[model samples]
Target: MPDQDTSDIADIEADIHAHLAEIAEIDAVAVRVYQLRVAHPTDLVAQLAERAGLQVAEVARAERHLARLGLLQPSPGGGWVAVNPESAAESLLAPVEQDILERRITMAATREQLHALSGDYLEARGMRSAKGSIEIVKDLGNIRSVIDDLARTCASSIEVLSPGGGQNEEAMRAALPLDLDVLGRGVRLRMLLQHSARGHRATAQYVETIVAAGAEVRCTGVLPSRMLIYDRHCAVLPVDPEHTGVGVALIRDTSVMGFLGRLFAHYWRTAEDFLADPECDEAAPPEEVGGELRGIERDVLLLMAAGKTNEAIALQLGISRRSVSRLVGRLMDRLGATNRFQAGARAARLGWLASVPPA
Candidate 1:
């Protein structure tokens, strides 16, 4: 019974040695030296080597490695002594655990602070509730301020649709600073303008400036309304579609913004790049402005021969009423006709409607 008890004790010690060696990444020589050192704490390196069947140098190297791992420490008498692994693990890991706790606390505090600040911002902007999400600003100056604030806060993309032909020089000059600011922050700025804008010198110059500064500008003949969508989360629209200076609507409702986003996307897909030609309108043939019909102008004539209103012609040709009106005026001048009916009759008589099939 005594022999069996001793064998069991030896087996348990062997298992413990193997487990500790594997966990601590200690080699076999180091494990054996460490075990002997623990059993005979007063033994010097030479004595430990003799007992462990290793050279004195091997025991000394293992002692150094163990000391580095915190499993051994300098003894009061002189040489190193084996340390309790539980105490060593506590000493080694306490600071790491404290660092993790501190990081978690800091993250929580920052998160709380940001949330509170966001709440205040939403409340101040009158966007906290579904009903309050739409802010109506009647003053033109206030509208500009709100738009500037939105532009500054935008984190991603800004979509702008400016209709009624080219922007005037004064408007472009006023908008240049805000445009540069948006581009500087790495926010994508996309502007969609009317096709007629390309003919305006001031508009072309402004487009060149913004394009050089990383703004994406496109032009189409048609746009539903003057709209500005920021980050796909909010949209600002002119309250009065015909007269933008009347007021503006700042909409934060997700569903309405989503619809507006889709509308902008639809128009954007069909719009042409503003900088497609370096010379722009100057590259056009001389005959284009001399009673010779352009492609769009011809199409406008055909649609007008079908007795379409400016609105109907704009819809059919995917252009604005302003463009259709301009086309009709030019067609009348070319045909020497005084009224819509006279223009159509003279166009048909002059073979202008030859390509169009009879209805």
Candidate 2:
């Protein structure tokens, strides 16, 4: 053989050694048959097939593979013997390793070429192409991609006006992936949840979950529409808040997006925080706010009925007079009474006092 040919064969042997373990584990039937032959090195083909779990043809294939890898070479006389494994290891493995490296290099170069082509394509298309764009998305599947793309590209903040009770199970399941993505990217998320959302079981739970994940959420009595704005660059809103059967509007006009952002900010400040207070759990009984008769509302009512001043009640409860005053206002509103006297009378008339008994 020529000097170059000897060097080339040596290179091939090196790559085969690098990936010998990989080829050995490709298939179960093949591996089992090979292992059987390896364990009983001098066994004849017929006896090996009988002893191995694989079919006759499979054992024959395994034998061919072993011989091709230089692990099973013909003996000096007649049969075969297992060659030195160290000699065979690289001899069989190098070719596979070379093929993998070649393919990886080709794939990486192709990907880079494609990315450069894409950049040229985008440049010709224009970066601020959305200036006057009003894309109509009818399919929910297509809308999901649009939202996901915006979340991935958003640089600064994500503002959302999520109204109409809480999100349905289907919406939660679908949006969770993108929602988590934006939050994890260090984007400031300000969500405006409508007051009606507090009544929703899933919505409340979802709020608690996202709040724990570093999202800012607040509830209000009214919201303009269901919208998601990413960094004042674009906004997505249902064409009609009452109906999504029509389609959704993806607006890229700077003025429209700016207005959407302002609306979100205005509501964010005015809306109430999504509290994790024990009083807020919907699973608790209707009468129990935080604890049975342990609620500030009930305590305030009892104190008011006894003609105790807000300051006196505050001192006894170890709370501020301002809190006691606020509790009085809330108690009156919840009881549908006009004043503290009326609130206390209503509580007594409703058997709230008797339900607790002397403590």
Candidate 3:
């Protein structure tokens, strides 16, 4: 009786192995079936044979066997449809079979290593690296992909230097909310725009929405360029004139990113606060005059009051010294003051130098 029992156990193991092999064969057939279903759902036997790498006669025999087992249904017109078994059976086995086939394909690809070879050749030859990643894309589709990826990956901060009214108001509106969601989770955001951006209704609305959501927005006159920096780790620059497409360089190297971060800071420092409404040039009461100073000029006044020179102020604010001098002249005219000293004195008296919490 014990010998008989051992015999039965060996037979069971053999049957299990045989069933596994059959399933492997069926998995190959399933892949063919999927392709056939896509290309010619009406022609089953040919597709199945092509997929199985078997003769048409052999595939027909296998199909008949599968149909007898109710694993496939024959159509009156032609071809066959898979009749999936109980979910439990498929769930238990199909995934393993599918995974095995995928690994096989991946192995085949790895053996050839065509993609990796191209990437390596590009890196080794240094041709791809020299162009700077942002310049490499040179297409709209690639730009969109890079921007979308950056938006998805940003963890803490996103700084944008946009000129000419900034990324189409509609696109900005859609993207800003996603960035705001990240900011809501404690990420910091800083945006710089061309002063001309103020003239556009879409940009104004976008600025208001972002500022209201607690992101910082600044504007500079005649901004020279556009950029988007994500987490201080990657920077994007527009390659196309229309700015519809851009090139992105992912700066993972700490030194490179640090340099880029400083550049962004330089721009941010000089940018005007967009949260505050600019006061109309028409004269108003002292209260209103102080309110107008609440914008970028007010910050400039405070910096000047600190006894910083025009060059120093320009460096700190990320604008040209000429711009600072221009600002100083405007403030002097506005406050009816003679020099920087008197400008500070008048700004203090008018309460313009008080630290305006970043709106």
Candidate 4:
């Protein structure tokens, strides 16, 4: 009966070895050695090799392969033992699954970081031109549209360096509402106009209105160019300084913007306040005034001396025709003159036309 039980155990062991050998990619010698270790849990390499019909070296090699696959382990009694296949698989794959999960988490974090960076990159690209940092905006209307869009988005300040003598009535009418809107939003609006703009009736009224609305205005005899800067990060300049109706250049270059900002600061520091009295004639050096004739009156005298009619003077001065007629009448009364020619001669005699700026 004992011999029969031993025979049954050997048959079972043989069946287990055959099943393990049939598994794909596992060495046959390693399968056999693992079966032997299971049946004789505390057997040394030499005893296991003799029972399995193999040399000690072959048993040792198979033990190494099974140990790497997690199929074998050290016994407490000082030999090798077989591990359960399911436990072995879990032990072999747990660390790999954990590594894969960690990699997936890292990938998600990297994607989030890239998404945030892409938003800033796209915004910066949208603010600049495709050709680079500079863009040429042709046509006066288009330039105004660009400026309008910029004004709406300006966060801190909007600054202008206007070189022409004075704005016309039509231009002032268009600008007033926009300037008031900007000031309404609490934006710092600063304008640098030519000193001669102060003498213009229409321009003075416009300046007065905006000043009351919280704008800063200053005047100088000359300006380098016609420029509009928004928040000091972007600038628009006339393509042709002598004729600004042509086109404009939009600049976003940081170095150029810095230089332009410095230049504007220099001019702003040297310029006089717009509402202040003129320190000197815009057309000539400083001199003492001998009469009550204002700069506008002197302009009228100079135009009349050059044979400009009331219509021409009104058009040049950006004032109404009726205002020019009334002004001519007042000047005639002041000079005690009977006509336009007498008004001019008397103005010259009073030295009023000597420093009058060109119409």
Candidate 5:
């Protein structure tokens, strides 16, 4: 048997190793919880747990662990609250502990890749350049920090291609202060958004606010790709949809950034200016608009309300039956109605049909 001191040290080391493994798992969970809180802070813990696929018991455990680490606290009235990093010095792990935790993370990634690929070949191929680093951060807080840092360090301009509306409205709101600070210091901001995004209240508000604060906003029906470029020095791309807890590649190489910048310019040239008053009846002729019901979504709503079946609407509009069905379903969901009649009534009550006169 080992000596008492040696045996004690060995046991402690084993405990540390075990704790390191748990830390990695906890990090992933914490990130997911942070994102949930950012997006839906008013949601109860039970709802958040359900969305995260964690049992209530598991959520309770995680809550306790986070509180103990000083990363979270109970809200004054109810629910758990996140402790901002500015007020979280006590939560910072010791240097040795951090090293051990980081090592465990690297080991976990290595093990996962090795198991999946059955060799080191894929891992080697996937290793990115340290000069131009690519890191996948599953934490929303970390992603926000990275964006802020890039925005601060940008020299000239920042161009963004935003999609899917404002996924993290709170985070975007929080980022306003930082954006204003950057603009105050003379950085130019340019954004390209999907035309449909203007229909989302949160997105429209944010776009208007940013533009009013000196940022340029442009709209386009052709913008399907999401991108963010900083001073033509770095480009950030979403590795995941929902635009939360995703990886961003910080490219410093001029050649790579230049290529991305070219792609951005190409898209920009084809995009429409949101600030410019749209020309009336330019895209579709006035006579053809109502007949085809292509751009006349309101006409489809009206037809659906008239109790016409999908096949009948298709025949009347000279379009595919599938298109009519899809349009009706979309309109119903948009109006938050259970049936065609309810949808039509809701649309009328909301004055959407009245707002857009029949062509």
Candidate 6:
């Protein structure tokens, strides 16, 4: 029943409304320019650009847009003339609102229809234990990739055993990026380093950096192998100890992972905090060091029993060489020994050296 001329105007109005809907600010500026053109009838893009603090080219773009929407028209003399705003909104804006609502309803129905396939997806590959979870990654590069993927996917915790604390500078540099990322994610990290780690100057500094980032560090004289357990869901073990570049096995077997977790807990319970008293020998228990000597003196006896020189003892036990000499003298006098070798013998006889590893 609508007139042909009215239908044509209505279609144009809808096009203009859809264009305006894209950006509210642009729409507002366009409409305001229409109002200003009606009032003053200026054809200068520079004038409008100055008023909007925009480039002349930008104002020209808006001008061309409004001209196509019937909100603007070329004047016989120069610039553009504003069209009636009331008629344009009635024809364009009202119909566009209805169009937007209908599109939204159609989109909702489409999404629900797609939802029917979710069960098939779950059956295919949704569960955590999905097959192929257990992967054997060979070569150093692939093994490093798996570790990094685990670090990135890690949501909760990490367990690490470093028998030597840290490797040489090249290895440390290779691992520094991933280590920093894991710590930065606020994942809880519990690491075990060897008691002799402090003796390595570079390793000592590396331990401090990780400790400062909230990782829990401890020392133990023993650990079976270098391992990494992630969230109790995956365990990474080396294929060969001597040549780490050979490869590694990433275990996702739950039972094996659970055993690794239990093993770590056992060691964690007895491992001394890396920041503990410098005089303590975390590698050897206090009872085996004999109940008679002071803690610091026990430290001296344990190092002496291991046959470390005074300089090495000072470095490992965090004391001056001169201080180590004085402490040895005091321990010898206490045991009635006249020299370092005899003092070691007397300490052994007293059961103070029982904890030291046999030569």
The candidate that achieves the highest lDDT relative to the unseen native structure: 1
Compared with the true structure, model 3 gives a TM-score of 0.43
Candidate 2: Cα lDDT at 306: 45
Specify the poorest-scoring 10-residue window by lDDT in model 5. 285-294
C-alpha positional error of residue 235 in candidate 3 after TM-score superposition, expressed in Å = 1.2
Q: How does candidate 2 fare on TM-score?
A: 0.43
The C-alpha stretches of model 4 lying farther than 4 A from their native spots are 1-132, 279-359
lDDT of 2 by residue, 1-359 (tens): 24755566567545433333334333555556556766787777778888875567878887677677576778776556666544564455445546546655765676666755643554554555667566667787887778888888998888888766667878887777777777888888888765446657887777778788888887654565788888888888886567864667778877777777777776665455666342332233335432334344444565555446677766654446776777676666666655443454456656554332111
Q: Against the unseen true structure, what C-alpha lDDT does each candidate score?
A: 0.71, 0.63, 0.60, 0.70, 0.60, 0.65
TM-scores, all models, native as reference: 0.45, 0.43, 0.43, 0.43, 0.43, 0.45
Per-residue alpha-carbon lDDT of candidate 1 for residues 1-359, written as tens digits (9 for 90 to 100): 45765665466435433433433355678778878888999998888999988999999999988787577999999888888754554554445445445645765676666755644564676836764487778888888888889988999999999986668688789889999998999999999986667777889899999999999998765566899999998888876677899888788888888788888886676566876642223223334433334345566776665445678767655556776777677677777655554565566655665543211
Give a tens-digit lDDT track for model 6, residues 1-359: 23754665477545533444432233545655655677778748788777766788866777787776556779998998877643443343445546545655765576567656644653553355643344546876777788889988998899988775445776666666777788899889888876667566777777678888888888765566788998888888875555567777677766778888998886676566776655532343433444455344566666664446677767665566776777676676676654444465567567665443321
Candidate 3 lDDT tens digits, 204-288: 8877887888889887544446777888767776543354454443444456667778877765766667654443343334445
Residue-level lDDT tens digits of model 4 in 92-130: 545544544564576567666775674466467668665
Ranking by lDDT: 1, 4, 6, 2, 5, 3
Clashing pairs in 4: none
1 or 4, greater by TM-score = 1
List residue ranges in candidate 3 displaced over 4 A.
1-135, 240-246, 280-330, 333-359
Model 2 regions more than 4 Å off: 1-129, 276-359
**Model 1 error, position 286 (Å):** 28
Off by over 4 Å in 6: 1-134, 280-359
